[model samples]
Target chain A: MTDLTRLTIAEAREKLRAREISSSELTGAFLDAIETANPHLNAYVKVTPEKAREMAKASDERLAKGEGGELEGIPLGIKDLFATEGVHTQACSHILDRFEPRYESTVTANLWADGAVMLGKLNMDEFAMGSSNETSYYGQVVNPWKKEGSNQALVPGGSSGGSAAAVAARLCMGATATDTGGSIRQPAAFTGTVGIKPTYGRCSRWGTVAFASSLDQAGPIAHTVRDSAILLKSMASVDPKDTTSVDRPVPNYEDAIGRSVKGLKIGIPSEYRVEGMPAAIDELWQRGIEWLKDAGAEIVELSLPHTKYALPAYYIVAPAEASSNLARYDGVRYGLRESGKDIIDMYENTRAAGFGDEVKRRVLIGTYVLSAGYYDAYYLKAQKVRTLIKRDFDIAWADGVDAILTPTTPDAAFAPGEITDPVTMYLNDVFTVTVNMAGLPGISVPAGLSESGLPLGLQLIGKPFEEETLFQLGQVIEDAAGRFQPQEWWAS
Target chain B: MSVDIDTVKRVARLARIKVSDQEAERMTGELNGILQFVEQLGEVDISGVEPMTSVVEQTMKKRQDKVTDGNKAGDIVANAPVSEDNFFVVPKVVE
Candidate 1:
């Protein structure tokens, strides 16, 4: 009741380690908060307090032995997209609403091994196809921050809306997030929290329900840049279970935080300074540049000439892969089986009834783009543009730019349902999608607030496996921000 | 750009979704809007642009052409809705 809400994982860990609190005590605070706030926020799809309490008791016992993994005693809100053994991981769709897996995803298992308590699964866009959480079958997520005297509900950003809203509201300290194209960063930006999409293959995806097999990467969303870095470090492990997961050694991300950014070069791509971008975003970006300059870092103007093509290319590639990846859900092996007299009827009936409108749209687009007659026109063309987008970044990075900084979303989070057409909504990821396509690392740090009191986010994209630089730049940008996105949801 | 509602119906069939006639008509308009939006990219001449897959400039690792999945017949059929004598039960394809 004393607003134990906004405390970071480190703060909670320190409190517990000092015997000032127990893991049960910390978990109780969040459990209480979830009960009090979840109906209003829809941040959590499920809450396993008994399971959480058991984990907390074990963590407290572990602390009694002076042994702690990096994330010990931490209560994490997992995106429902990850499979949890015996827990319903529906990917926020009715099709999988009853589909509880018998196996846990590598990421969730690793976090559990690191001693993190499961606060239960958070909501996500249905199959993570939409940029805004509104597409979720469970319902839309409201932004934790509301303008004074206005009853207009705002978006918490999507497809990780529930994760962002929960973390922003302090219902959980950190939530696991996945990004194929800005699912993590866009929601983080909308909620005024920190979210990172690590280099592709940084985290194992064996149990994750796939959206785009070629592009999906999972990371963490939390209250601070350092906390995001810590959570990311624990979640990433090279797993033999995931064929696409690279066997790269995980780096010491915690050590990289608070490092000086003196003499670091930040690239400012003029192309990203899009026309009609909100003025508040511009001011926040300029402030970020000034922060770097004040820290003895140099700013350079660069051009990613193929920037305009990224959004189109991503639409083609993401949907194409999503179509194929989702082909597994055809009422056969597992999940929401529909009984029909004939085999073909069973597959069609289950899928047609199971999937929502947005999911169906992606499946159609995906099939169309990959079809024999049109594959060369759409999918192949997009692949070519994808190459140019990558080359554009290669040229800039090769030009001696250490990292590129841009507004994570071209605009701050919008009022829920303001976007009617889906493509306009998909365009929201114009800035963040390129990084996922390039298999590079990008982090969204809160820059400041807009005049309307919504959070503005500055995205820092680093070269492949250059997460340390992202953390470094993120810290500098955080200092310049000076204002936390209004997270009033916790106090209430 | 003449639009065709029949193509939308065909797409829904291929996607295995039973879209109502009304929904198909609506989808035709929406799909056209998306195609128009994406058509903006065609303005930029990618005349000789090379298609690239994997965003990372590095090459993907190739797996040996060995069979790692052939022996899992029992496991593959474990979740089958209908199975008979270790074989997945599908409706007879031809008479």
Candidate 2:
């Protein structure tokens, strides 16, 4: 039989319902694939085989009685950011050493409610802080896609690197990921998969580790646009535990997969053509515009003047919130604890030894911005810039623009350690951060391959609570560019 | 705005994360690099914009001040690093 691990969520759903494959049989296939490929890919931080088998057995029994749920019997990898009951839920940080949550995150609760089987916890940047997954205490996740004719390993983008790599490598049907700035979209773009960061408060943030609370939103990374839509429909819901979650019905997002983009106005921001952008990225953006135009959609040239300031402003705001959010990891609480002579010294020692360098850097920067004298100059100013960034999008929408399009990342995946400077690394979120600043939904769909044969994605930004439009436009791009999967080299 | 060694040290203390002199030196350089990059934000004209804290414009949900669910002390303290008699243990604050 062909690899069951290679099936999409939709494909697996059909086969499971037809009684062609048992849920346990499907779960076993992925476990075998993970056992063979994970050592080289490093996509998963921890594998829960016993838990997976138990869940798969339950799903199989449910299916036998015609009681299958939407995600019944499908194996999915979860990012380390989400809390799974009694599982290793570290956000790939040493500070969260040996910590396991007794309760499930609301997002994961929703998935489990719909009968999705657990594969394991995937790796990510430490505290979801870096552009590359290098800051993780478990080490960096290797991208499955390599430049043609090269033996060197490349990065699977960060924060959700493991989630993207796992889906792209066919280790799991799909994976859940988060985005503060561009954690989900950038990694998806880098690894040639589909990722969506839903609007703020679209999903509950109760059990997930906080990065930038106002900016962090949960979404999914999957192999196809329809698969991403399917996973997101199961993932999103309102919760009393999260006050920000909107009390609105989640539209059946999969219905929007084949929706025509006819008569929709797509905006192309002039400022996204930044200086030093590579020609290939520009060509990809142009191709995306042409694809939408061919689909009977009107393309409009627009301006987001504050776009250039997004990266800098994000650095200020995200770290400022992160520093406040991450302060709860004290020695007295759960997780790692280093001994000291006194309470104060104990906190200092535990935090100093537990956090990675990148995490410490962000914490210090956040503290500096939110400190006594600099609050008005740094934190307040960044918030104001954030307002302007949102207003730019609001204005475009008010002018009848249905969605905005841009290149997902400035470039395709870079070699591990290729970017050393912090400022240069921050630029990876240049095209995607404005969406977060506006608290809007954005998605990266694999559009085409780069010159070196690695995949590149084009991003579409949608208005608040209008993820359906993005799915519609993303599928148009997906249909035009076709699907891309990397040749299997991890097994070799 | 350059981040000096003392500023880095002060911020680390404020954040309650211990940093040695060597780590502080490296942190100073990285923090300065980030601050310098974000200095461009100072140029934007924002005389009347309000700082956006949350993106969704919704009123805070209100409910009666009643305990909906609780009293599971074991579940709450199950993951604590140190617990005694179902209470979280911390260093004594008072002499």
Candidate 3:
């Protein structure tokens, strides 16, 4: 059996209901994991032990009275980007060093109501900008899985690195993570855990700190697909607080788990097999395809010809929106403020002091793209490419492809500081960003480990709101995916 | 593929971040390198293309135009480097 620390939410819940352990005991074991793992991994910026215990105590009361919700006293780490009433959500930047939120986000509020306790805020790249978590002011998150024969520090992907690290280290059963462009999935891929970014309009963004407001959607990072399903159901709601939130009814996510993939159509976009990808990863992708074929699914060769342009289009569109959304943080507004000589200077000084280097870099890039001389040249050109990229996926789905398969990142996690050139760093997200740009649902399931034993994930991208297909096919691949879950931290 | 240092200084000032001359000199080179790399987007011609202003299809996420302050007065002011009551404090306007 897996250690209590690394048990999935389903496993833990079953154990709790059968009186194998109390809620407090379950919470304690995970909390112990957090204490042991956090120092080494730097996954959490804050660990709320007392608050976790209090929630666990409440769960015990609910159980004793024969009342139970989906996630009773399950502990998960929250990315600091989510606003929790009274929790200091710094976004891992010095600008909000003393910032505290007054109200919880719709997602965080829903998790609290579902009886999920937070293990406190996890670290992230400042304002969720970088592909790697190294840009976080707090520090970089080391990948929990080490190279089999080497003792080097590796990166757990980001800007959701903390969530992935904590999950891989068995610090939390699951974590709340957001993906603007592969923030959740890439990190999960790096750390050998499962992370899902649901359909774009599925989750409310009212209280979550905005990145690219349009692309940011929060979901769960867990050990199994079912745990992700249950957490997804509990968190999905038509939140009227966020105007961008859709009024769609939540689906019975877990009800569909264990459903068979008798005749599903999976797409392998011809373009995704990039020129320089590793042979091991190429073989792993092929293996996942073979598993689906054995399960009676049809493998179709689809073309998203414009897939090559996804990264460039995304960089333009995301930063363009982010430039505008982030304007709210100017000194006089809600975020941190810096005093200056006059009103104008105040805006200048405050923002100057508040934002970190990467945030500023993005702001500048965004501003330049939106600038008069360049607007028509850069921003407009990128948008046109976006339309073509969407058409590529639209054509594939039209060609009877139920879902598309690709590697989450080109390869497994890299060692720290290996890729310093920002453009090279940006290229790491090549396969994952396309899904976000097209506003589709995509998931990273652990395919297998690399030759040196680092994790590799097979990304399955489905049509928008077609997450059900992804989950069904995932079950088949997961059965054959031996040793996909994290090896025990102690065993190392 | 070189960016003028003066242009970097101007962009930095526009961004409202205070960068030293030495930093600006270094950043000018870095920014030039980044721009040169990002300039690859210009390789594809996109005549008559409209800009994608928002990723989410929504034009704006609006709430009711109610006549009430955001209401979390204390919490809003807590992060202020300087605050008084429910408002952020700044230098007095002499005008």
Candidate 4:
């Protein structure tokens, strides 16, 4: 038979329902794929084979009874950011070394309720801080996609890099990822995968590791738009655990797939046309507009004047929130601890040893901005700028614009160490952070290949709680661009 | 809005993260670069704009003032680096 690991979630779901394959078989195939690919890709930080087998067996029994959940028998990789009960829940940071949670995140709990099997915890940037996976204490996750005939390994964009890489490499049908500022969408662009960061509260933040509380959101990464849609339907819900989670009914997002975009207004923000963007990214974005236009979407040229300031403002807001949220890691409750002569000294020493450089830098930035003399000049100013950024989107929505389209990243995935300057590295989120700032839903669909044979993606930004619209528009781009997958160079 | 070595050390202390003198010197330049980049926010006129407290407009949800979850002290400290009788063990501070 064909590789069961290669089947999309929708296809695998049908096959399992028809008894064409068993959940055990499908789960085993993914486990085998992960076992083979993980050493090369470093995508999975921990593989839960026994737990997967146990879950698969339960799913098989449920399937036999004609009573299965929406994601029945589907296997997925969990980003390490989510707290899985009795499982490693590190956010790819040494600070969380050997930490296991007794509680499950509301999002992952929802997935399990739908009968999705957990393959393992995927790697991510430490505390989901960096754009590249280099900040991951577990090491960088290699992008499965390679430049044409080049042996050099590329970074799967982060901090959802492992989620994107695993889906592209077929280690899991889909994976859970979170975006504080473009973590989900940017990495999805780097790999040939579909990722959606639903509106800020679409998924509960109950047990996911907090990066930037106000900006962080959980979403899914998958090989196909339909798979992402399916995963999201099960992932999103209003939870009492997370007050920010909207009290809205979870729509069947899968139905939005293949929905027509006839007469829809697609906004093309002129501000996204940043200076010095590569010609290929611009061309791909143009192609996305054309694709929508051909599908009956009226393109409107618009401007979000605050777009240029979004990144700078985000650096302040996110790190400020991050420093506050991360203060809980005081070396007393859980994870790694370094002893000192006193409690305060111990806290300092533990955090110093536990956190990586990027985390430390951001924490210090946060502390400085929130300090006695700088709060108004820095933190409050960034918040005011954030208001202007959100106003830009609110205006666009009020003008009857259904969704906005843009290139997901400024360029295709780069090789690790290609860019070192922290400010330079932050530009990766240029196209994505605005969605988070505005509390909007955004989806990245692989649209084309770079001149170097790397995958490029186009993003769709929708209004709050309008993830279905993004899924619909994302399918249009997916159908137009077709799928881009890497050759199995690592499958030795 | 540039950060000096002294400011970097002060911020690191406030953040409760130890930084060596050498690391603080390097961090000074890095933090200054970021602070300079964000200084552009000063240019945007915000005389009337309110600082956004939340992205989505929602009143804080109130729940009944009753116990919902409890009696899991063991689980709470299950992963603690050092624990005794379900209580976390930390360095003594009240000596």
> Alpha carbon lDDT of residue A430, candidate 1?
88
Candidate 4 residue-wise lDDT, B27-58, digit = tens: 99999999988988888999899999888888
Docking class of 4: high
TM-score of each predicted structure versus truth: 0.94, 0.99, 0.94, 0.99
Could you tell me which 10 consecutive residues in candidate 4 chain B have the lowest summed lDDT? B86-95
What would the per-residue lDDT of candidate 3 be over residues A156-221, giving only the tens digit for each residue? 989999988888788888898999989999998898888889878789988888888767888888
DockQ-superior candidate, 3 or 4: 4
lDDT of each: 0.84, 0.93, 0.80, 0.93
User: Cα RMSD for candidate 1?
Assistant: 2.5
Question: Which candidate number has the best lDDT?
Answer: 4
lDDT of 1 by residue, A1-492 (tens): 435666777787788788787888888999998888898989898898999999999999999898877778889999999988878798999777566776789999999999999999998899987887888889988888776567678888889999999998888989998999999999999888999999888899889999998899999999999899889889999886776677789997878887999888899999898888888888888988888899888999998888888887787888899888888887766666776667676777888888988888878878877876888878888888887888888888888889998889888777887999888888899899889878889999998887877788999999888898999888878877753756464345
What docking grade does candidate 3 earn? acceptable
Q: Can you write out model 2's per-residue Cα lDDT over B3-61, one digit (the tens) per residue? A: 89998999999999999899899888899999999999979998989998778888887
Off by over 4 Å in 1: A1-3, A483-492, B1-3, B57-95
Highest DockQ scorer: 4
- The residue-by-residue lDDT of candidate 4 on A290-309, one tens digit each, is 99999999999998999989
- Model 2 error, position A70 (Å): 0.7
Model 3, CA-based lDDT = 0.80
Instruction: List candidate 4 segments past 4 Å from native.
Output: none
